[model samples]
Target: MDSSENYRVVCERVAAAARHAGHEVTLLAVGKTQPASALRQLAALGQRAFGENYVQEALAKQRELAGLGLEWHMIGPLQSNKAREVAARFHWLQSLDRTKLVAALDRHRPADAVPLQVLIQVNIDDEASKSGCRPADIGALAEAVRAAPRLTLRGLMTIPAPHPDPRRREAAFARMRVLFDDLRRAHAGVDTLSMGMSDDFEAAIAHGATLVRLGSALFGPRR
Candidate 1:
């Protein structure tokens, strides 16, 4: 299918999922490894929020699409050396897995720039290879992020380990929802639950994901 057609299908599915959940869910078009033109095509269809994994690649795309007025998000594992650039560029940081990284982002964020929206990525499935804070460490990290003058703690995010059983995926997403609710009760103004992706976003939504990151479904398998 063409880009426009692909985008339409994804949007429809997202909307349906949101309807099923009875909440508004944001579709974060994962643009990692995609070209500026692909972004422009999506942007033309009224897509504003885009997710990227690599800071350098995102920066290049941001520059290329400077005239488009899109909102970029850093959704991959971030490095200490790359914090400043991510702080200066992306509007949202969804992979905030450590307190030290939070401190770096807060310190380097330009005073004139808007406060960066943040989501504490929780290692829900506790995979050793994943880049997210353990579920037990969320409170401390959330507090640290809340104290950061330049960061706005939006909510929690997680990339659950893929499972063959649909019920297992649902269970993980439901667990994330519970954590998200608990976080909201403990912290004021906490709202977003950035979980889900192309494969299991429907399940994520069914269990209460406010944001779903999509790549292949919208952009046709990344190059």
Candidate 2:
């Protein structure tokens, strides 16, 4: 499928997933290595929110496409030094884990901008390589995020272990859901769960993800 045809199919799936989740879906086509034009094409296809994994790459896209009315999301591990620019530019952040990064985000939160929406990334896989706090650590972290006046604790985000066994994936997502529910119980304000990606978003939604971020599924294979 060309970009146009591919976009149609992707938009349908995104709409279905949004309906299934019973929440507003930010289809956030992940454009890590892809060019800004591809992202712009998707934005024309009605995808307003976009996610980028690399700071430099995402920053480039943001700079180039700033006129397109894009809502950029920092969906990868954000370095503490990058927090100021990330907080000032990106509207949503899904990979906030460390306290120092949070502090930096709060300190740099743009006074003229909207309260930055945040999702505490949960290390559901407990992997040594991933960039997230453990499911157990999310609660304490939530307290810290809520205290930041310029930051709004929307909910939780997680990257489950990419295992063949669906049960493992489900367990990881379920663990994140537990933390999501726990936090929601404590503060009714934190409502967004920025979970799921191309491979296992359905399971993430089944476990109660409010936002499912997709990339290849929407834009087709990256060039």
The model with the greatest TM-score is 1
Stretches off by above 4 angstroms in model 1 are: none
| Candidate 1 C-alpha lDDT tens digits along 157-201 | 999888989898889898998999999999999999998888899
lDDT tens per residue, model 2, 17-55: 667867666566789789999988877877788899988
Q: How close is candidate 2 to the true structure, as a TM-score?
A: 0.93
Off by over 4 Å in 2: 20-24
Model 2 global lDDT (CA atoms, 0 to 1)? 0.83
* Cα-lDDT of candidate 1: 0.93
C-alpha lDDT of residue 138 in model 2? 78
Model 2 residue-pair collision total: 0
Tell me how many clashing residue pairs each candidate has: 0, 0
Q: After superposition, how far is residue 117 of candidate 2 from its true place, in Å?
A: 0.6
